[model samples]
Target: VKKIISILQAARSKTLQQWKELDCSITIVANEAKDNVRYLYTLDKYFGPLAHASPVMMEHIPSLMNTVFMIYCTSPYYNTSEHMTSLFLKITNQMINTCKTYLCEG
Candidate 1:
């Protein structure tokens, strides 16, 4: 879990730096981040059901929930396009649902 968080944090920081250096629009940055997340989700073998069921991961549920809520609440500020806004909301909802499922079922 710590390694996952560290990797994600590093990716996020790199993304932000690249966004600034390239002077890309917020929508582009958001889309890139979303794509990266989608790619990560595809790696279910690394974070599948058994991983979620681990005691260490289960203990972090509250922290994960808080992070998800923060992301959902702050997404609008980063969304500049109508399509991106809708997509962001959809993704956020999915994340929240996943977190809820893990917390409740684990």
Candidate 2:
């Protein structure tokens, strides 16, 4: 988990740097998105299963959520490919279910 956080932090830095380097016109160009789904997919792969998550992991949720939101939520939602949209829904539903189970178990 710590490694994941470290990676995410590094990615966030890189993304910010790239954003600063990009011109205002390039940001609006179509089909320039590269592996935008990777974030969503990788997140889904790991966050897909939380049934055995330790309480300690839950404690990191706030910090991790903020990092993830800054990294991913800033992207425009409309440009997502169909595949990404599907994965997004899957991940969203999976997370909702995990939250329900986690809270109900308490």
Candidate 3:
């Protein structure tokens, strides 16, 4: 679990770095792995616990949430995939609930 958390944090940092370095045109490269709803489920299941248990993990939540929202809003997946769309909605709702719980407690 600790290993998974470390990897997730690293991935988030790398993504934010890439977002900062990208050019203005904003070209969308379609990656099947990233577009998969199952992957989102995996992320939620793995990271959700860490977020709940560790303050350090919770600290990255806002940035990670923003990055995810921006990606989904801008990606082609936003328009397509009815099933995955529902999954994304559920994931977002779960994320919101988690954030609320943490924020209120903190």
Candidate 1 ranges beyond 4 A from true positions: 1-53, 77-106
Count backbone clashes in candidate 3: 0
lDDT per residue, candidate 3, 30-97, as tens digits?
Answer: 35445655335434534655446345665665755664565556555543567446756775676677
Clashes of each: 0, 0, 0
Candidates ranked, most accurate by TM-score first: 2, 3, 1
In model 1, pairs of residues that clash are none
Best by lDDT: 3
lDDT of 2 by residue, 1-106 (tens): 3454456567776555444445344564533354455444444434623434345446555654564555455556434466445655665675667677667886
Model 3 stretches with alpha carbons more than 4 Å out: 1-47, 50-80
lDDT of 1 at 93: 62
Least accurate stretch of 10 residues (summed lDDT) in model 1? 42-51
Per-residue lDDT of 52-95 in model 1, one digit per residue for the tens? 43455445546544544444455544324654466546645655
